[model samples]
Target: MGALAQLLPLVRSARRDQDQSVLSAALQAFLDFGIKRTSMVEVARRGGLSLATLYRRFSSKSDLIQAVGLQQTREFIEGVDAAVQQQIDRDAGAEAQIVELFVAFLDGLRGNRLLDRLLDTEPEIVLPYLTTKGAPVIELGRDYLAEFVTRLQAEGKLPAYDPLPVAEMVARTALSLALTPQTVIPLDDDIAVRKYARDHVAVSFRVPVTDS
Candidate 1:
């Protein structure tokens, strides 16, 4: 009986993986051919599945887009955690470590096709997820920043401040700059943005910006 139960979960998980694969393919098709241009039949074709199968998993295109956006957000947070772990293991300086993790998070978002489409081409799909108070993605970002800042303060790397509140403010400010139309931060200008984020951290913690 226990073996049967374990096997049942594995079977359910496999089915779930298959469903996600179909959805991922549909998302790629949507990215390639805009939301309005893509159709359910086309997505199924791109996914190498039957229309019935696709519709069974995602009732509509809008639903699929939302799922992809949420998945992207989850993956992005995981990437940020990995980057933070990597930086800490290397004993990176406090400010440098924070900026590195922040940049990694931004980079992950930039590479997300669903998010890119929503941000750059379809504001209708993007605005709700970003603006909503209880949105999962926004909440994850806020929580991650708050935790990181708190850790820094606890480690004596940063001054004792209310990390959650400060991190929330910083996240909001950064999001505003990034999401604003016609305002692009070129991370490629490597030194400048790095210096900018680092300096902001220094000011926030009331620490001197060191010349490294």
Candidate 2:
């Protein structure tokens, strides 16, 4: 199996998140059978949990799926945040960092067995979370990027500007591209994604924005 096919290491650096604990079993079951085929009972059994206990936590399978989407969104943010930071340390510019986040995320999603399975086998179940009803996941990424912009500002990497809108732009663009793969942009091709990010996305960070 390629590295991408491996289960994403849910624990990254020193971040201890409960989403990993709450959703690992569901992730595994979904990985094994895709969300449509995996029942709540199977999820409970895989976790050595009772159906009642599972219901107490998630209320329903749709609820569990929502939690999983939230987990995937948060993990995606933190995971690529670290990648961008690594690029910064390497003296990589904003464009390179953006490319790192963009490609890393899409590549990770491609390798994400559970999510990939959902896209392949059950689009109706998962598409809403990535699209029309995607506010929860998209908003999570936007908020994380908002806080992340502050850190970049402190490092003198970005000028003073409202972080929320900028963060939302990047978050929405990245997530949207991942969901809609059939573009002029060949997202599967890392070289193309890097070029796209450099030309279109990273330009914002290249120039300083003065407060109006």
Candidate 3:
């Protein structure tokens, strides 16, 4: 079975913008005092709500964190989808859209307060989530990339090989690049990053099609 079959099924949370403010407050709490140090009370205080109100919404700290994660995943996917659509509207080429895949990911990740703060101050805390405990997030990325790959292959921009493995590679690499600060890839340089993505990461997903 391919990775897509192993992909986690994403369900849109019933909680809408009303609870998003609470999630944002919780995220701020995590940013201010790290995940371990942040508490439900702090989230409630930051959100300007009573502790009972907070607990009424999120049963526990664990529940709150999971909600925050689900919300973040939605935001990340939405941002990437818009970027891809913008690229297409501009009549960008296949290579350009492929470049946008990696480009849009890291670009969206840039200046993410929680992510940057966590990596800078508490690598030990977040590294595991990005690596070992990463199946949930990775599966989400895998599904998105796999869908994109299937479309590209249908358009004859990619080979007829399976899209799941290719998507997994791209997804995993994209996540790794986002989390890890040290790399020869030169992410600090936007122009260089796009060039590297177009020439390297994008190319790696496409296999040679032989005359059968």
Q: What's the count of clashing pairs in each model shown? A: 0, 0, 0
What TM-score should be assigned to candidate 3?
Answer: 0.78
The better candidate by TM-score, 1 or 2, is: 2
- Write down the lDDT of every candidate, Cα atoms only: 0.63, 0.68, 0.72
Off by over 4 Å in 2: 1-22, 90-95, 186-192, 206-212
lDDT of 3 by residue, 60-173 (tens): 775676566656766787789898788665344457677777778888777467778878887887776667766667777888888887777777766788778877887788
Residue pair clashes in candidate 2: none
Query: Over the stretch 44-72, how does candidate 1's per-residue lDDT look in tens digits?
Result: 88778899987776766766665555555
- Compared with the true structure, the alpha-carbon lDDT of candidate 2 equals 0.68
TM-score of each: 0.68, 0.79, 0.78
- Can you tell me which runs of candidate 1 are displaced by over 4 Å? 1-16, 48-56, 84-90, 109-113, 132-134, 153-156, 159-162, 184-186, 205-212
**Candidate 1 accuracy as TM-score:** 0.68
Could you give the candidate ranking by TM-score, starting with the highest? 2, 3, 1
Candidate with the larger lDDT of 2 and 3? 3
Off by over 4 Å in 3: 1-14, 47-59, 88-91, 207-212
lDDT string for model 2 (63-124, tens) is 78877766766677777767666655535444455566667766655665666678888999
Q: Candidate 1: lDDT of 203?
A: 65
| Residue pairs with clashing backbones, model 3 | none
